[model samples]
Target: MLEARDMTLTELADQVGITIANLSILKNGRAKAIRFTTLTKLCEVLSCQPGDLLTFDPD
Candidate 1:
């Protein structure tokens, strides 16, 4: 998604009022949970829906 938008992690973090490390965690799929507020901010900046950011994986 970031790639599609030509956005960098640092830029996202700055726009979302989050830290690069935290965004990095989400980027790496190491996040256990994401707050609705944060999710909304991400969608707002990236011009995407939550479904665009979420995926269902069965392992």
Candidate 2:
């Protein structure tokens, strides 16, 4: 989605008030959880729904 939006990690990190490393962790799907506030900010900035940012894979 970031690539599709032409947004860089650094740019998003700054916009989201998070460190690049933390954002990278979420971006890489290595994050065990995400704060609702952070998720809200991401959705606002990315102009997307939460569903767009998350996937449910039962594997």
Best by lDDT: 2
Colliding residue pairs in candidate 2: none
Range of the 10 consecutive residues with the lowest summed lDDT in candidate 1: 50-59
Q: What is the lDDT of residue 35 in candidate 1?
A: 98
TM-score of each: 0.90, 0.91
Per-residue lDDT tens digits for candidate 1, residues 1-59, read 88999999999999999999999998888888999999999999999999998877765
lDDT values of the candidates? 0.92, 0.93
Candidate 1 error regions (>4 Å):
none
Clashing pairs in 1: none
Report the Cα lDDT for residue 52, model 2: 95
What is the overall TM-score of model 2 with all chains considered together?
Answer: 0.91
